[model samples]
Target: MYYGSVGGNATFLLNLPPDKRGLIHENDRARLSELGEAIRNTFRTNLAEGSSAQASGTMSGHQVDSIFDGNPDTYWCPEEGTEQVTIEVDLKAETEFNLVVLQEHRYSQRIEKLELEVQQDGEWKPLWIGTVVGYKRICWFDKVTSRYIRFKITESRWCPRISVFEVFCG
Candidate 1:
């Protein structure tokens, strides 16, 4: 609910009903706490944070390596008019992740279609495909361990600019 709500540009609200004594039910309180812990555990660390990033094309001043620097101000943009480009991330070690979160620069053109791939046995295999990445897109796939993964922008209104590229398990 948290990811789906935020990813779709909405706020999530969970209404808790209290007992006749005006105290929140223990079951409800416990469940809510569990939900909070689950979310925290899933996103506690980004598997790709501070790792190496490479792209097929890049515009001046927007280096691909800045994607995981934890800064939203900077972004990676492809060369002018480059419709199709691929961004690859090196986690430095085989790590398992099932979720990919991508956020576009605030002012860049929207990405229409993007695909995720993982390298296995020297071959790149497709994992997930997404569309309409207006501001953020979350692709959830089966958990897999890999040292390398890549995101390809197949269609965009213009050159796609990515401000945040994150990978996680959950």
Candidate 2:
């Protein structure tokens, strides 16, 4: 019975008290973890291929479009007095994305925490909440639609500024 069960590629091992039912051993648990990883990798997809980004406020020389200019040195810094800033991205066409990549100014810790939202049916819905992100942050969540991606900065370390180099959705 052990030989047949061990090599049968079974996903679940039943444990019963009446007949000393088999309990999944280390090998079986390892196999299950591998299976789960394979499933996640198989369906992962990037949905933010050609989206355009926009911001709520910009500084004197730092414009909102700087984040998408494909230059690391150029970044978008929010205007003063706008304590809470937002950066919204228009996906052009509706799509599904489960990952968000935020690239901050090389070594700045200005952005301490932020929230991500998506537009659905003309209303904005919360998607993900990011915290303790210094330079770069990759946020992952269950697949959601990408009509309008909004990144709101709620907490900051200093300067009341929202500085970001690039933001990617996938």
**Top-scoring candidate (TM-score):** 1
What value does the lDDT take at residue 86 in candidate 1? Answer: 93
lDDT of 2 by residue, 59-133 (tens): 888876666565678777777656578888876887766766666666666766789998999999999886655
User: Would you give me the overall lDDT of model 1?
Assistant: 0.85
**Cα-based lDDT for every prediction:** 0.85, 0.63
Clashing pairs in 1: none
Instruction: Evaluate model 2: give its TM-score.
Output: 0.64
How does candidate 1 fare on TM-score?
Answer: 0.85
Off by over 4 Å in 2: 1-50, 159-170
- Which tens-of-lDDT digit does each residue in 1-170 have in candidate 1? 77676554345777777799999999999998998899789878898886898898899999998788888899889888888999889999999999988888885547888899999988999999877665666788899989999899999876888888889998
For each of the candidates, give the backbone clash count. Answer: 0, 0
Task: List candidate 1 stretches off by more than 4 Å.
Answer: 8-30, 107-109
